[model samples]
Target: MNVATARLGARALNRALLSRQYLLRRLDLPEREVVEHLVGMHAQIPVGPYIGLWSRLAGYRPDRLSTMVTNRELVRTALMRSTIHLVTPDDCMTLRPLVQQVLDRDLYTNSSHAAVVKGLDLDEVVAAGLALLDEQPRTPADLGRALHERWPDRKPDTLAYAVRNLSALVQIPPRGTWGGTSRTIHASATTWLDRPVDPAPSVETMIRRYLAAFGPASVNDVQAWCGLTKLNEVVGRIRSSLRVYLDDNGKELFDVPEGELPDADAPAPPRYLPEFDNVLLSHANRERIIPDGLSFAEWCRRYGLMMTVRGGVLRGNLLIGGLLNGIWRIDKEKKSYTLVVEPFTKVSKKDLTALEKDGHALLEFAFPKAESRAVQVLPSR
Candidate 1:
């Protein structure tokens, strides 16, 4: 494959990524279609996908996704990076098997549980765990206690962790439902989705999807996003079919032939992103979306404002003109919810006004039942 001499600057790559991620503009597509297009949403936090979809989809409703969860059309399961993701049943079946190596490596190298499970027969453990989950979905603690009956010498939680990493377990519903709180429960993905893992999962197809959603990226970027390694070989195999370009830094980038590259100056309205939004986390070098300068944490420290986490979810980010410029969080009180926006640097009045308007809309979507709603912008220090 002859490498093209075309070049793309950071802004050009940024626009292309934002356009692919639907951040440049909201789309009227169905939530399921959107979820599939982006591969999946990082869903360690139950509310993360709800807020993610709300920001990217037109007329998005939490109930629509909640209903999907209850119906088993969408599942929260361990997939990319061995982290829980909200994905369609089709993706779960296909992707879980494809990334099984990442999960296996994580189990053997994990500091907390690796030593305990060192000599045990992990295949036997996985089979037993799946049998138990097939009978009924169970929380990790409950599953651990049951597994302890067999591995009398190991820590119950450690045994459970082994099974979690070894098997394709899907966190059953009511667990991921919106406005609902429940213990994390697990069932075998085969049992939950009534589908076996894909016998022939495709790495090439996975790479193509990644590029479509978060691409014009380097090989390192693809590996970073999926927690896989040695993808350079896969990219090489498909190189001739890809459009090649060099970033300003001269790193080679790859994209699908039809991947859209919007103008560098395309208007990017203020977008409120959920905690762990894939757009921010999907790239190895996030300079395309997160502007170069002081890191976000450093900026927060300089301003004497801490980026807070509540119930395990970090504060959502504030994106202005296609770059991550600030952070926001919703503070819940007895009868009200307050949306707070804090910029890393001084923001112009025009940008602040736009942020406030969109911020209010987000407040309404996330906390419509609150007796009062307020949006506050902290002055840049």
Candidate 2:
């Protein structure tokens, strides 16, 4: 449980994260179980959750997850530092009280969100939103307008953030379902699940769950991953059970007692991750695992965007390697996808073949079945 045992070498870290994130091999477990294991699923692009499950499950079932959302087993709620996530309905309840601390912290000076919601009655807004949604779920815009009728002076934008984010709500199914493209509307999580929400549990439990999935990390990493703050004390209590290691830069990292620290020589293969993969967003220090040459910044202009979300960014698709190699976009008009791979540098024939295969799969998974089904290899300029 000391620095040396936790050193774990670099490749060891990569394998552990990939395995824990369900990327190394597809597992055969219930969809709900997987969601719980990962704490929650990263949900930026609505359909990304299905592909994410596909990449992780042994034989994936889109229906099961879709059904869960439909049946209220899973709910789409803004969570974990105010980012969207597909968490189990139970988590939605249990995690809310724990999340309030995060929202409160952001209201302070020099914070990114900076009390964008100051002077608002958070509870009243929550009740008003629930009342509007009780009749039928409404898109965020629809709900906001309805609420605005009651409070004319409030900035609808600020009011909506308070109701939708600060309170308990879910993005009903069909919005987040496979092939159901539409704007996000808000629904009351309580009404949708027909279950009373649980008060947030101790931060200690939250820290343990995060470590179970993405451990051997620092307190800062946990905060970054969850978008929560004020947890140094929870870390202190768990320190006895954790093993610590110094990063290449000499910062101490903490991990679970059972977290696997594999062999330094473990070999990893190329992995095509969905947008905002937990692997990409789970660390305060992403470079610790993502090689410097392949850091996502080259692909990401902002936090949620990537050069390629589904397939290709704006006209180019990305041809990435073990690290990000480069980005690309196709020039097709309709029904056809030409591979315009712009690797970081010239790739060998073997690597080119791999890139082509990965790119093709990404396109098929990204677009509707009939559209963009064909991938033509274009001459790299």
Candidate 3:
């Protein structure tokens, strides 16, 4: 196969991500299919995947996603970075085992829990935890208490963490289901989905899937998303089969041979992204979405200053014309709903008008039952 060497700057990278992630326009696809394609959205925050889907899928209904979760078609599990992600059941089965090392790294390498878990019989812990969860879904506290009784010598927290990190424990509904109370109930991915985990997981396939969704990325970028390192060998092994590029800084970037690159000057519209959306979290270098010199953690800390409402804890982000220009929040009253946009930099008068128009539309989507809707813009900080 002929390989193309395209030099992709931030805009080419930005447009590639927008097109691949279906952010440029809503795609008429099932929620499950979209979830699989993106390899899953960052779903640690409940209601995040719904808002994420709303942003990318045409005519998306919360009920469609809720039903997918309720019916066991898609699952909320610790896959990438050992964080909860909403993924199709098939992807969960394959993706979980591939990233098992990421979870293991938390237990073995991290100092916080390393000594506690050391010398502990991890196999027994996994078996015991799985047996308990097989009997019924369990909260971490409940599972920990049960394990404590069995291994009274060890801390319950350690045992619980071992079980969660070792075994493929998926959070079951009403956890991720839309418009439902989220409880911390866990079950074995094997038992809940009634499928055995893949014996051999392919790193190459995982990287390919990632590129199709979030690429023209570097080795570090893929590592950042999956939380595993030492992929220089894996990336090198597949080098010949992939198209390569260089970032403006001369960093090497890789994408699947078939990946699409939109024009660097393509027009991108305003998009409302939920807190912890993959666009912000997936890349090792987030300069395409986040402004340089500002870390994501620092940005969130500053955003907390503007947070006024008490609702879901995740802060939503605003994407205007392909760059992350601001942050936003949704406040609902008994009779009305308000969408507030707080831009990080000055938005043009024309752009502000366009933003408010989309904000009102988002308000309707977010609070369909409210009799009144309003959009407000705070002065740029």
TM-score of 1: 0.95
Clashing pairs in 2: 139-185, 216-255, 294-324, 315-329, 316-328, 316-329, 317-328, 317-329
Model 3 error, position 57 (Å) = 1.2
Candidate with more favorable, higher TM-score: 2 or 3 = 3
Candidate 1 runs further than 4 Å off: 293-314
TM-score per candidate, in order? 0.95, 0.83, 0.94
Compare candidates 1 and 3 on TM-score and give the better one. Answer: 1
Q: Considering summed lDDT, which 10 consecutive residues are worst modelled in model 1?
A: 305-314
Across residues 66-181, which tens digit of lDDT does each residue of candidate 1 receive?
99999999999988888999999999999988898999889888888879988898888888888898888999999999999998999999888888888888898789998777
Candidate 2, poorest ten consecutive residues by summed lDDT: 313-322
Candidate 3 C-alpha error for residue 241, in Å = 1.1
**Top candidate by lDDT:** 1
Tens digits of per-residue lDDT for model 3, 37-99:
999988888889998999998777798889989999999999888899999888888998899
Residue 6 local lDDT, model 2: 33
Candidate 2 C-alpha lDDT tens digits along 1-381: 244353544556666776677766567889999999999887866766786786677656566777788777887787786778888878888887678666555443324334545676777877888888899988877777887888777666656666765667888868888667667878787888887777537778888889879876778989988877767877887787777876666777787778775555554444445555666777777764555623465445532445453355323223233343344554455766554555544566776676677667656555534355544544443
